[model samples]
Target chain A: MLKDITLGQYYRADSVIHRLDPRTKIVGTLVYMISLFLFNNLICYVFAAVFLTFVVGLSKIPPKFMFRGMRSVLFLLVFTVIYNIFLSTGTVIVKFWVFTITYEGIQQAVCMLIRLFLLIVGSSLMTLTTTPNQLTDGLESLFKPLKIFKVPVHEMAMMMSIALRFIPILMEETDRIMKAQIARGADLENRNIFIRVKSLIPILVPLFVSAFRRAGDLALAMEARCYHGGEGRTRMKAMSFSAGDIVAWVILAGYIFAVVFLGVTFKTFPEFLVLEMKAGLEYLIPTLSAR
Target chain B: MDIEVRNLTYEYDSGTPQAVRAVDDVSLTIPGGQFVGIVGHTGSGKSTLVQLIDGLLKPTAGSVYLDGEDIASRKFDRKHMRSLIGIVFQYPEYQLFETTILKDVCFGPLNMGLKQEEAVNAATDALLRLGIPRESFGASPFEISGGQKRRVAIAGVLAMNPKILILDEPTAGLDPGGREEVLGLLKSLNESGLTIILVSHSMEDVAKYVDRILVMNEGKIFMDGNGKEVFSHVEQLEEIGLAAPEVAYLMKAVHDAGIPVATNITTAEEACGEILRALKN
Candidate 1:
């Protein structure tokens, strides 16, 4: 059951999406996400959906494998759908004793639902195609300006990569420890919520101890290898952008422009999209989008 | 209790590209109150086989009858299987979390719903049976030597009074003296009527101690026999990245040198007796 978690999982395949530079993929994902919120009509959604599906096909990752991650976010998806269903206001399409369903409310719900789904899937595409090391390298390079302010960017990036490397190792360790406790008759399953939490103390206490021990051993191993806070470290595999990445960026820029253009021309764009864009941008930047 | 495995098969991460048949169509039996040892090279399914017997893993397509109860069946009581068959995994001491050795040892029996005093008595009895001193009972398990901590971990499982005990490389990290101490403890316990399943890579230890041996290779039972009989087929054993016991090799060397000694002697004492008898003749 622990193996079912697909967080930060990368699927390795030979495809245009996987072969593109990590920076290009990261930037392209950002542009694609921004384009998702710049639309409010069925035509714009159709264009977005087609673009996404095309990219998914190009990536060569199985659709079933890609969407398997949505299981974890099902709760959030349902919550947002319900929230938009009753709260969004407009012409009342149906009226019950205490509840009213509006045409605009249904439209808003569909838009919000599409946006949320696209947002998760779009970002997951980046992680699925790129390795954690490549992702870290891209992020560190993007955040290189922070080094000018002496923010220790290199050390932070190194720590993150090491943490990612050990996640599977720690997960396997937890599985073993849980099995050991179970052989001792520790009931991790079949308990009430309160008792279950209490029962986890046996599992958690040892897990914490072993984790600390592993951390200590890792620190010692690093010191033995003369690791000194990422100073003067050079990557063996250097990062460089190629022509394929340029083509990808060009397509993304065109896609963003088309979404913005079609979004504005859709009837009801003035009333519905203005409010949605405002809400979306406010989420991106609290201060800048307050207006 | 007896364990009867019939056509047992297990696969890790089945249906994916990474799927592995760690144990395949393997059938065997561990009769009650027997000292049995399983020998295999790395990835030979030795570890996976033991876990399957105790219900830690369910077989994909087979049955495990633990004393006439189908342990793989849906109605089988999993918790009862756990208590019936205790497993001390490799480096078992790493799971120790209690402050004192006594509490750590009592953890298993307490988990089985024994009263506090009864659990304490059972734990103390287990520690005594393993020859752990009373003075060390109150000490922290972390404060002891690596060997002592391993014994404490084993004692924790023994406190449950399991009908069958399966240990996976119980002496893996210990020194030679500690290894003998641990093995000696296991030998005496086996003699005193606790069914023991010893899993190890050390052919020397298994040859010297266990009366019955099961050799595994690539997820299948390659050979099974008495220690003397299994160790006699040195070449076949070596073909699969395993070797006969050191004594058998020693006797073989003497025989090749025309000393006319039997090369099938697996234990040191048996080799010594055969060598002495040959010299007298």
Candidate 2:
């Protein structure tokens, strides 16, 4: 029944993004997110939206799936929008009850919402396209320079991989425990907040007990197989910088260069681009909706 | 405690790309106080059928009638129905979380609104029914042997005092001796007038105990009959990824080798007796 949770948001499909080297995707996502924060006005925001949509389309992951990750942070987005809309000062659009909505407030809210939406979608695409194992591998390679500072980077990656693996197992365990209690007539639904929290004790106790047991078993199994620390460990599949990865880096660099250039151009010629974007949107939105 | 299922079907993820017709158009009657066995290959809708029977899952279509009353109706007392028809899932032993064996067994009865003393009494009675020793009543369920923990788990359900007992693989993971012990208790319980629905993958266990057998295949009841009648159709059962009891196959092999013996034997005891008689002749 709890299967509706599409968390970890891994969209499974055959696409260029899915096949891209995890390092490239990771760095690409970082550049994408950094540019999202760098964009200052409507013109750049529109370009950013276009860029994100293009990447999402190329990834072949459903738009629904990419936005599904946004569902978890929807409240934060709304709160930020409301906070910025009501609290910020500019040419007032309306005034009511110690609150004022300004034209600037509307612009900030829209820009913030778009940024939040793009942030979630961009990150979700990376996770959805790259498997957890690949993510761990990418992180390990990216943090390799820290190994000189005595960081157990390999060990950290292994821990992450194990944690990622246990997520599904723990989810199944939780479902079973919840059902077992429910079958015994433990009412999980229709409880007040306090009682609901208390009702979870039955689930928590068994879950903790099982988790400990599993961890202990895993440790023993690892020891029995003569596993030590990650000091001299070697990977079965070593990471390589492929042609696809180079293409991804080049595209990402171009995107950052465009955003930086756009930011400078916006600083120098704000009125020209802003007026043109306003007119384009005013023309485009109605036609899009009519279609 | 008669259960009549009428054209029941359950679909998981209905209308999705991965939609599954788990139990499709299945209808059957479980007579009062009878030991019936449900057998099928994994994912053959055996578990789905039992879960539907207990109202744990609502059917996508059709109804389940208990004593001619439709249990699936919106107004049915779901809690009372669950109390009346207890379901012990596979590996129920893993569900034990109470501090003591007695406490663990009492959970169900207490949940049904019994007083503390009454719940304990019900739990004790159930434990005794399964031959669990009273000396171990106060012991932690975690401290018990694997087989004992399973008994304690079953006792927890039996404490509810259900008229119909539904077990999915009650003897699963038990040693041969533990399996026989569990089956013996089920037999006695059936004799004492509890309608028992046993879902199992072990055809030998089913043949040894259950009077009637239901074979599920591709989300439907492919075969329904007494042990003899159902086991006789070996080919049909095999086609659906099931086989008759080894004893029945032994008898069939002997019969096919030109020996004059009954081919429908479903128990080792009966098959041995027939083979001995054939040897003597």
Candidate 3:
């Protein structure tokens, strides 16, 4: 069951997005995420959705596979939506039992949910299409200017690549350790949360120990092969911008310009939908009170 | 307890494009007190089949029956399965976590809801049976040798007093002497009427110990028989990138060289006796 995690996992596909430079995808994701928070109107969100769908389509990743990453953030999504719906102050549309639902509150919650959803999907697309090694190479090349300020950009990128590589290894180890503990009759599925957490001690201690051991062995192997940091290191697949990357950047720029332009021109939800929601609530609340 | 798997199929990453049938429509009945060895090349679904039987993985189709009761049925007590069938995964020694060897072994029985004294007694008995000394009981599991750590891990499962034990590559990464010791221990355990299923690639080990051998290839049971019967199809085994024991190959060469010895010898002792009888004739 632990294998269901799709976060930070690369999906292999022969597609335009998969072959694009990792730097382009990474930068495009950042631009898309920033644009998501820059706009709150329904029109901009629709535009962003169109953009996200187009990119995801080009990536050739199955919609189901892409959405599986949403499961991890589902709890946060629900909490944020619920929190926004209750707390945002605005014109009240329905008041029932101490809970007030406002038009503005509904609008804000919808916008936030869309923002979070788009943000997760846009970023996940980057990770899903780009391999870890390519990502590190792209990042190191992108941050090459930081070397002038004495920053260990290459080392940091190497560490990130290693950490990313270890995610699946550690997950498999945790799974094995969990099964071993369960085979020994460890009650990991206890209903009590505290007991469940306590039972995790058996799984965690070994996971951490093995992770450390693996890290040590990896370090020794790297050293044995004369890996003395990323200095003087040459990449087999050098990071170079391609025509597809340029096209990706151009599309990202257009998306950002559209989101910003629309966000500036329209500061709130469209007026007619708000009027219709008020009318609907006005007709519904009195009938409920009459009952 | 005898285990029966009926049309058991498991798919990893099910419902996705990358879904693969790890165990495909396998049906097998393992009677109680049988020493069965499952031999296959890597990625042939041996591990997946064992995990499915252990209930670690829910089959995409079919059911597993323990002593004629469907273990996956809602009314079946899953805890009873956990306490009855023990699984020792490959590199089991890496699962050790407790501060002391005794406490680590005690983790199982205590989890089974045994009282403190009873758990300790079970743990001590298991450790002693695994040939761990009394003085080492209080030592940290990390302080032990690799083989000792493996024994402690096995003791951890044995303390649960499981009737059936499944080991996946129990002798992997061990020296020849340690491999023999572990396999010998398993043989003795099997002789004591505890059902054992060993998953190993070593044909020699399988021929030396197990009564029944199941050869898996690409998620299917390619061959199922006793060692001699399975090894007799040496060409078929080789076609699957597997082989019979080295002695079986040697005996085949001897028979081809016009010796009157049998070509189906699967173990060293059998090969030696067959060769001697041929020479005597």
Residue-level error in angstroms, candidate 3, position B244: 1.0
By lDDT, highest first, what's the ranking? 3, 1, 2
lDDT tens digits, residue span B111-186, model 3: 8899999999999999999899999999999988999999999989988999999999999999999899899999
| Candidate 1 share of real interface contacts | 0.76
* Candidate 2 docking band: medium
Model 1, which residues run further than 4 Å from truth?
A264-268, A278-291
What is candidate 1's local distance difference test score?
A: 0.87
Residues B1-281, candidate 2, lDDT per residue (tens digit)? 89999999999867545579999898888889999999999999998898888877778999999999898778888788868998898888878888999998988888888999999899999999888998989999898899998998899888899999999999989999999999999999899999999999899999999999998888988888899999999998888888988988888888889999989889988888999999899
Alpha-carbon runs more than 4 Å astray in model 2: A268-291
User: Model 1: per-residue lDDT, tens digit, B1-281?
Assistant: 89999998999988666689999999998899999999999999999999888888878888889998998678988877778899999989888989999999999998888999999999999998777999989999888987888889999999999889999999898999989998998898888888999999999889888979999999999999998789889999999999888888899999999999988898889989999999999
What DockQ class does candidate 1 belong to?
medium
Name the weakest run of 10 consecutive residues (lDDT summed) in model 1 chain A.
A282-291
Best by TM-score: 1
Order of the predicted models by DockQ, top scorer first: 3, 1, 2
